[model samples]
Target: MLLTKVVALSLSFASVWAAPSPPPQSSEVLEVENAFTASKTAPKFKSLKASAAIEVYWHVVSKNSSVAGGNILDSQIAAQITILNEAYSTTGLSFSLAGVDRVVNATWFNKVTDGTREQTEMKRALRKGGAYDLNVYSSGFVEDPRRLLGYATWPWDYAANPQNDGVVIHSGTVPGGDNAPYNLGHTLTHEAGHWVGLLHTFQGGCNGAGDQVADTPPEARPAFGCEVGRDTCTADRLPDPVHNFMDYSDDSCMTEFTAGQAARLTAAIATYRTQ
Candidate 1:
């Protein structure tokens, strides 16, 4: 979710943290696989009646932050949780804050990775929850925006990179914080959508498997700002879903997850996150 005046690919995935990519390339949908089939632990998702609130633990990292103490306030984090819950309130799923931990490291805070060196070290040392609780890490910057704003590990990626099994976001995207247009805290809402199993509404750009979900219309690219009544994929009968939480729309523009996404979340949780 590289949210400038316009939306850029979440991040360049060659190095670390795969989110939405640039215009020509695919979005995070390219990097994320269907973890529902990749899970080796929990059984396949079947029952829809199951409802459980997921626990999320926070790890705040800072050293050279532009902010005062480089640490986000507990109240801010709580408010972010409230926003997350609000977005997913209709789904049979939800998240509760487990706790918050902080680390003041300059080197780790500066560099994020994809199981290479420094990023792996950060995750190995700081990561907490196993397959259940969501471990969220906040840092100074993700190092590249021609690619990303935040990135999350797919539920299946946890087994291979257990330590890196969470989402990393900038400290300013929290509500009433910095990061305008995106200051509304929907960045977490979007990335967490990926953490579960959702994909960008414009996933395949009107081509191949679009986002792996039905009902969400396709777009040739990520939406910029809140362009309502805009349809990128005109050939398809359905209009582009800029208002979808998974798309790169502005925080204020993004609102809902399709029923397909809800079902996918249920299955994804059952298959990969059930603990």
Candidate 2:
């Protein structure tokens, strides 16, 4: 889930946190997301009847032994799955780690930005399982001047681009890691939301059909830090959802997904990911 604007934050560790580039929000993508909103009819995908268990294939792409270079430990990866399960507890979707593979490649580790040749090659070589299985690549985006945290592909894009259907995260953002404010493992949670079928909480920016969810109030922009009671869209009755995982808020600031979001997740999983 890439944001439109790049937010440059100077942290105590002197690490700069910049937003990732935007995913393609074309009409087809919008239609796929909005389809759940239009009708409550269950999708043809069979595995999404009540609850769906997604198999996660973890791929660690590193330059060397350094964790900063993307060689994250198995414990950190397990901690991330725990965080994701807690965050998505109410969504009726759960993730199980199917396998973990580590690839030591300096070129792939440093150059795996969104839509780049390096990213394509890396995913094609490392991606595992079918559309239902989640392939998570922990890699470095050092080549990008903005230092993107992570990005994900939509479920609708899987048919045409099966190899690209997965999530790429900055290895430093895992739990007990160096990237502060984002190290609590919420980056994967946020990107996983996109990987399923969620638009940003601030998708339409106070315009029509914001995030296409009925429960979440319209948000004018992404919230950076924990700005409690901050209301950007004054016309709306509720304050900004800075605590939502889908926003640009820090890991500590993110909390829960709304009921509408849960419904959307179920619908999206049924509609796209299921067989």
Instruction: Compare the candidates by TM-score and give the number of the best one.
Output: 2
**TM-score, one value per model:** 0.83, 0.88
Residue ranges of candidate 1 with Cα displaced over 4 Å: 2-50, 64-69, 113-116, 145-147
Q: Which digits, one per residue and each the tens of the lDDT, describe model 1 over residues 22-43?
A: 4324444444443245542333
Can you list the residue pairs that collide in candidate 2? Answer: none
Cα displacement (Å) at residue 39, model 2: 9.0
Q: How accurate is candidate 2 locally (lDDT)?
A: 0.76
Give per-residue lDDT, candidate 1, residue 120: 77
Regions of model 2 farther than 4 Å from truth: 1-17, 20-52
For each candidate in the order shown, give its overall lDDT on alpha carbons: 0.69, 0.76
